[model samples]
Target: MDRGTVGSAQSGRLLVEVREEGSSAVVTPAGELDHHTADVLREPLEDCLEKGYARLVVDCSRLEFCDSTGLNVLLGARLKAEAAGGGVHLAGMQPVVARVFEITGAEAVFTVHETLDAALAD
Candidate 1:
């Protein structure tokens, strides 16, 4: 795998970078992810699944914030990936973003990794 960015999308609040690692599509979204910027992250994730990268690793170390809509976008991706025999893996989640998942019990539904490297390794 080249590890180069296969695609990317950026909005005012979010910048999403997509790359390939083995069979997993690593999507890194930096900055705030809210209702207004959810699509910036969603499109790249959906595109990864469409392109047959069923495993998704979200490197959220750079992500500073995430709202409910942002969580929904991830949940949606998880469902899509699961349907295709894959699942979403969340890695390096910041405290704020992780809090949302915790509050919503979304963490229970996905495989959460402490780091991006760990996520890809699994």
Candidate 2:
């Protein structure tokens, strides 16, 4: 699979990497995903959908933080993917990040996995 970076690294807040795993597009976003950096993740995710990659796995093992903005982006992606007869899976969330999903009841909305491999298996 070809690996590449998405978005400018100059922001120093987030780094998004895009790669393909099997039939799924895996997006790994590191650093803080807040209002300011949410777009960093959005663009690549949208690209995956546009490319007809309906099965998307977000490998968040390196993700340090996530706020409402980040959640919104995930939710939007989920909706879009579902409409396209695909689905978005979130994997390896940090405790703090997982807490955000739990607090907002988004855990029920998304398919959460303990590892990227597990998500890919699904």
Among the numbered candidates, top TM-score falls to 1
Report the alpha-carbon TM-score of model 2 versus the true structure. Answer: 0.92
RMSD of 1: 0.8
In model 1, how large is the Cα lDDT of residue 108? 100
lDDT of 2 at 52: 91
TM-score attained by model 1? 0.97
Worst 10 residues of 1 by lDDT: 1-10
Across residues 8-106, which tens digit of lDDT does each residue of candidate 1 receive?
999998999998888888999999999999999999999999999989999999999998999999999999999999999999998888898999999
lDDT of 2 at 109: 91
Provide the overall lDDT of each model, using Cα atoms, as 2-decimal numbers. Answer: 0.93, 0.89
Per-residue lDDT tens digits for candidate 2, residues 6-77, read: 333324799988887877889999999999998889998999999898888999999999999999999999
